[model samples]
Target chain A: MQRRLFLQGMLGVVAATRLPASTLLPLMLNGCQREPLLPGTLLSACDDARGNHFVASIQPDGSLGFQIPVPLRAHDSCASKQRDRALFFARRPGRQIYVVDLHERLLIQTIDAEPGRHFYGHGVISADGQWLFTTEQIYATGQGMIGVYRMSQPIRRETEFSSHGMDPHQLQWLSDGETLVIANGGILTHPDQNRENLNPDTMQPALTYVRVRDGALLESHQPPHHQMSLHHLDVSAQDQVVVGVQHQGALTDAVALVGSHRRGSDMQWWMADELTQLRMQQYTASVAVDANGGQAVVSCPRGNGIAVWDMQTGQLINMLDIADAAGVRRQPQQSGWVGTNGAGALVRIDSSGTATALQTLRQYPLRWDNHATLI
Target chain B: MKPRFVRKSRYEKKNRYVRKKMQLLLLIVALLSLAACNDDMTPGQRWLATTTEQIRQGYQQLSAQTRAQQQMADAFCQQPDAQGLQTMQAAWRESMASWQHMQWLRMGPIAQDNDDWKLQFWPDKKNILQRKMQDILEGSEPVSADSLVHASVVVQGFSAQELLLFDPQFATVEKFAGRQCDLLRASTTLTARVGQKLADAWQDETWLKRWVAPTATQAGLTPAHVRNGEILDALLAQIERIKNDKLGEPMGLKTRDKKPNGYFAESWRSENSLANLQNNLLAVQQLIRPAQGYGLFQYLKDSQQQALADEMVIKLDNAQQALQQIHPPLTSAVTDAAQQPALQNAHRALGELATFCKQKLAPALGLTLGFNSNDGD
Candidate 1:
């Protein structure tokens, strides 16, 4: 698949009609348009005007690679290393899941949650790419459950186990690839009650680690504030877990929104200075760690700003403004990270904290969702 | 000097002066003719003109209704009689329905200053208005226009007035005398003041100029296309809000249990939830395709999207018809078993209308709905 796309890209260069060889010579001599397109893919769920949801693959240079329509709105997606397929989870309280084959640019399978269960909009693929783990909720009991599926031609649900917490949202595989870290957003919601948080006052959010082999509870940690629902997370190569929180408390309260945690260690909450914290509005939509694992960035859609932090030092690096920005992902093999927003903007932030807008993809009409994964 | 040469030079100079004067006269005539034709106005400008006129008319109606409401409340306060109370209730309903007409114009001045919420604080999901009204009525918070300005927003708007006029506990003359009457008078007066201010704001000539000539502003709305796109987006947004939040929530189409929640309905206490929706749809229709003049529909037709415009008009008509079938007191219709089907049908019609506005109208107009804060988690 990669080879075919490469050949096609080369053909595009050779067949350029607007720029003749005479003009191309001067352009090449000036080293303009010389940067080649990045060699990787990024996947996101985009909503069209017709109410259809699509899992769209974007190339590194922000050009669209492929798009396959899904039955419902999708949130975060996980890519498989052993195959050319990716799993797109339905938005919270939705029951449908779609598996798409990027190589063929088609949906290969559809999985529906068992009765009385619904997805939390996030999932993770196992290291060997043989199994997929999804965070689900038993609506009747408000219990978090993990549904394991064997990744095969006709994907089969292998087994299920407790998530050891309630309302488990985004989860990631640990560096060891044997343990999974889940951000158990403690807000109690039932399908019967719609999207209302039923237990905001007494919510108990936690970050839990469990063994994928047997679903054993390895550890669990919670922030001091109960109303801070840890909903999104990304693990670094150094096994550092950076979590983004959504606050359910009063709007007047000032609380930390980004936290860093390591297994068996207390979760340390780091916040921007007082002004920046106030600007965050107590919500972090998405989080991403650089490829080197030394820095992390969080996108605050409410504040319209992205904050970069040194994961090791746990100090604020800088904050840059982008309107309605949410999705954040590390650029493949680069120290910088790329972010997308609801205003149809694609921006790149280098390791030095300089942000540049990639103008090519800014014209796409769809509002990018919460997470974009680099494949 | 020779007499013949001098005479010839003077005649040539006179001829040159007369020609310059004639040229200036022709230039002035041409300018006047161009101004008369109004050929500089684009389709978007024409649509904006119609929209602003409708907004101005809607706000003026609200002002009149609110002023009448205030006067009726004053009369009731002075008489303290059953007849006066009935008149006050009638006036309150009229004022509320008038306010509903202006709800769709949720941009510019109305959008600024939290005027929408100040005019009506809705979805009182937790009965905040009730709780706050009770507290203020029992406490010694001065019940005057000045005090109500800083009072809880929940207790200063239409919903608060609805409770005083319709709720069983506060409807009677004896139950609503003294401070309660004062609160009613004060709330109504505040609404009237706000309504007048809104109307006056729209009357500003500069605002109208800026709105109609969006490209002339420094907001970087460079081309007329960008300006038209924003107008289209705002129009569709109001329709979406009407279908999704105003109607869908009360009808239980958006709730989790799929069971009707009457308390979620707007103006439920006054049994005017459906009336509010009807007025909202009326505003939408008038703004899109006014009866006697050019509007968004005409703009689309001028842009060579006649089929899309025609389909939108049909969908909007269907929605209006469906709404007419539902009875008053939408609160009861949503929760009542027998009336559920009609409510569902009305919801479906409105949903289709909203879909057409979003999918068909937006794309044809080259408009995109920007990121709303409430779209996702």
Candidate 2:
């Protein structure tokens, strides 16, 4: 009789608390009983930031792979190989792109981009491998733009696209095949002064989509919420989009929506877009969509956690605190990473929510602008 | 059948609920522990605390005395004066005494009973000399040349003072007294040998012979090639006197010579009386620039000992510059040599090197004057 009463009391407390699932699911995922479906797996990681150029592969069993030399200096990041040709970017001297032969891993040609122009540096290649898109920040006038480079031509032709907002950082490709999505990271500037000139009072954040069938912008989408500067974005196999936002401190910004597109007409923002105001201090630096597009993960480096959202439920499912989430990446055998920033690390999260770290990447301590791309 | 079935169902339901609650509590505890254990820590602090203190202590235990001795040597080298030279010689003796003792300590009994005589004579060398004295007491005087040769091994480890103090044939008063020119010559040779050994340690041999001759007794003699002719006559004539003496003469043999004033002076002047001999002996005594390790006679190898001299000169110049930077510079009166722009700069630099060697490196290395000097005397 006494044990029954005790059990009843516990149930009563849980029901009355109405505690959020997000506050509890993280505990379950990070606990020992939650066995990783693919434990100790590895992946390839590379940091093409500095003059350091090397590739590290993590095996399926979590063993570190030998470092393979990639003949490029300060590779910002790498892109998927197109017809045995891979593309990488470097910053020393000036911002430029190099096309490399994947088998030989050697640069065969270089295309110089805008010199003396400050580039925010994250870029992605088109699925057909005919286009390369990168972000550019013009410090002189505090204006930012998207650079669309045509790689199909004998000489790479660059077409400048103005960022819907300032300080664009990364871009993603939509399943529609004709649309290119971008994160216009809202960062203002004053070169005449220092970074101290960032006007938090007058910053706008937006996520843009451009219809580019033959390389051009079409339509776009914005959360009608407030200015939550989206910094990085990724797409899942199921076509769900994950966006990380650096919100300008305001009560309305915190309520930005994140979810999957159920249909062209039913595609609406997450309902959480109305809870409270968002602050820049709560901004995140990384975000990725799960392989199946059922989940989205956003990393708050300062929070040391990856905030997970369930697209199916339109609910914030979990937040995995990995101590150093800034260095974390999605792996096939695990849901989150525990690594360092600017360190080369490749991670993949599979359909079963298993993260597999491809390999440990060497910190390419180069002297230039750097970014990463999916290979 | 109905009552039994109902009772069993109730028990199963209670067990299931209890198990669920227990599982939930365990899960919560596990989560809390995981969160606690994953706390972050700052890096580069592990090796900071103890290693830094150890490095500081290592630096503090340096030998300052040897550095001071180097300074004294530099001073002697620069001044080439009687007192500076004597001080250096004394310091050399002190260093040799300590070094020999240190070797004795380091070798312990391993250096004893090594029938190889050379090796055995290292630590118990004093005993070897004592043995020789014992033999002498048993009517074995002058210790045989073979035994003397064996004793030389012990002598190799002797300090300068020990070499001078160890008198075999009661020659201490005769050979080292005011009239004992042979001991004076021997002393001069030992002083030079100390400097030579220092050079040898530095792997410099070209100038070693000039500093220390093969025979310690032969080093202080006048150059065998010096001629007494018109030049000698002119020098002697200026004195308005005549003297007589022979190198191979007996102790009392003498010839008298008279001056124009009819004053008759003794034929052989006392060892203390011959001004030239005394002056030469004093010069040789004052020239005892004893060095240690690879540091002695370091100046001699310089394109004229240019390396060592330049080191001394440069350091002194820096020190002078440093001194000048002081609000009120060091109150050193500028000498005539220092008045010349170049010489002045050189002297100032040399002085700084001298002070640095003496105050810093000497004690740092635990090196002193003749760490292993006094051999072959």
Model 2 over residues B1-377: C-alpha lDDT tens digits?
46754555777888985786455434433332332244321111111111212212222211222334445544544434445545744654444332322221111111112211221222221234445433433443343223333333333223222333333443233333332222223323333343333322222233222212111111111111011111111122211111121110111112112111111111111111122222222221111122211122232232244455445435534633532332211111122224235323433443444444434433222222110001000
RMSD in order of candidates: 12.5, 36.9
lDDT of 2 by residue, A70-112 (tens): 4433334444523344555442222555565443444566666
TM-score for all models, in order of appearance = 0.64, 0.37
**TM-score, cand. 2:** 0.37
Encode model 1's per-residue lDDT on B173-284: one tens digit a residue.
Answer: 8977689999999999889998999988766656554444432211222234444555565656667777777778777766446676778888888888888888888888
What lDDT does model 2 reach?
0.37
| lDDT by residue (tens digit), candidate 1, A1-375 | 453344334222222344466644543554423232223567888776445678887764345667787778898887886436778889899897888866566788899998889999898887777888999999889999999988888778888999999999999988999999999999899877667888867788989999988889999998889999999999998899999988876433557999999887898989776446655667888899987788888988766677888898888887666545668888665557777775445566665544432211333556678888776
Instruction: Please report how far candidate 1 places residue B94 from its true position, in Å.
Output: 3.3
- A142 Cα displacement, candidate 1 (Å): 9.1
Reference-based TM-score, model 1: 0.64
Report residue B192 deviation for candidate 1 (angstroms).
Answer: 4.5
Candidate 2: residue B121 Cα off by (Å): 80
lDDT of 1 at A261: 93
